[model samples]
Target: MHTLKVDSVQLAFNDRKILQDVYLHCNQGEVIGLLGRNGSGKSSLLKIIFGTLTPSYKYVGIDDEFIHYGYLNNRIAYLSQDSYLPRGIKISDLAAMLIDQLYWDDFANLDIYKNHHHKKPEQLSGGELRQLEMLMILCSKADFILLDEPFTHVTPVETQYFKTIIKSISKTKGIIITDHQYYNVLDISDRVILLTDGCTKHLKNVDDLVTYNYLSGIK
Candidate 1:
């Protein structure tokens, strides 16, 4: 099984320390839910793991080898909070670039792709584009995926649908997902981590969220 381990992460912006100490581990077939309040550095942590953002110090690796940049060689795929598709790129071309051969038919045959493959990113509505981007990231061929606020701007039905997709895809890829929609994160995650005060806390159950005050109480 593939393993991704990270620890000893330290990040700060000017005088404020965002993350001081953290440890996270994931292997194939696991989905780890990351929860934090606003400005808690959940997005920064994902960017650090993906190598898009430089942290003061960090240790990210796959197996035992150090991974300086997780995005190199498609070792990991990242879906940031912001839109990633460029207007100059065609939808079909982006698909050819990111989708694995084994899943091409499944991806190409999706109604969303069929409806938008011929149009530019600018042509789709904000919500439509977000849906397309989310689908593409979840379907891309990568050993691991880091998703930041994936459910944002998505409809309730789409949120539920994507939750199923995430769980299904986790059988082959290790995934770390974070979003303000805490309930959705909890619903699909195999295990959960709450980031607070520059620390990582592993929760034993729903009650732990309460302990951290991340949630008022169990739903």
Candidate 2:
């Protein structure tokens, strides 16, 4: 199985520290749920892994090879919190550039794409645009994906469908996801990780979320 590893990550802004002594690993066919309190640097960690943000110290690798920048490798993908599609681009053209050939049929068949293929991104509703951005990343050729707040601003039905897609995609790619909707993250993750005080806490179960003060109680 392919593996994505991030270790020895350290980040700080001026005197304020964000991440230090962090380590995380995900294997193909597994989903890692990342849970943390606000200002815990969850997005920073994902950015570091994606090579968009440079930490003070880090060692990232996929399988046996070390990577200095994630985008350079092309085997990793990231979904950010905000919409990223450019203007003046048709949904169909965007798909042609981003979606993998192997998953083209499945990508083209999604209601979000099928209905809006002829429209530009700006024409769609906010939620609809979010759905399309996510699908493009999820259906890419990358073997490892880092998703930040993926479940935000979507309908309950869309959230559940995204979970299904994530689970199904995990059969072939490793996924690391963080969302304020902790339960949604928990629902799909094969393994859960808590980011606290700039370190990674590998949780044994949902109860650990409460213990770490990420949640008051687990129902």
* lDDT per residue as tens, model 2, 1-219: 889899999899997899997998999999999989999999999989988899889999998688888877468899999788899989899889888898999998898899999999999998888888898999998899889998787999889999999999889989999999998999999999999999999999899888889888877
TM-score of 1: 0.98
lDDT of each: 0.91, 0.91
Return the TM-score for each candidate structure.
0.98, 0.97
lDDT of 1 by residue, 1-219 (tens): 899999999998997999998999999899999999999999999999999999989999999789999999989999998889988888998888888887788889988999999888988988888888888887888899999999888999999988998898899899999999999999999999999999999999989998999888785
Clashes of 1: 0
Compute the lDDT of residue 172 as modeled in candidate 2: 91
Q: Model 1 misses residue 19 by how many Å?
A: 0.5
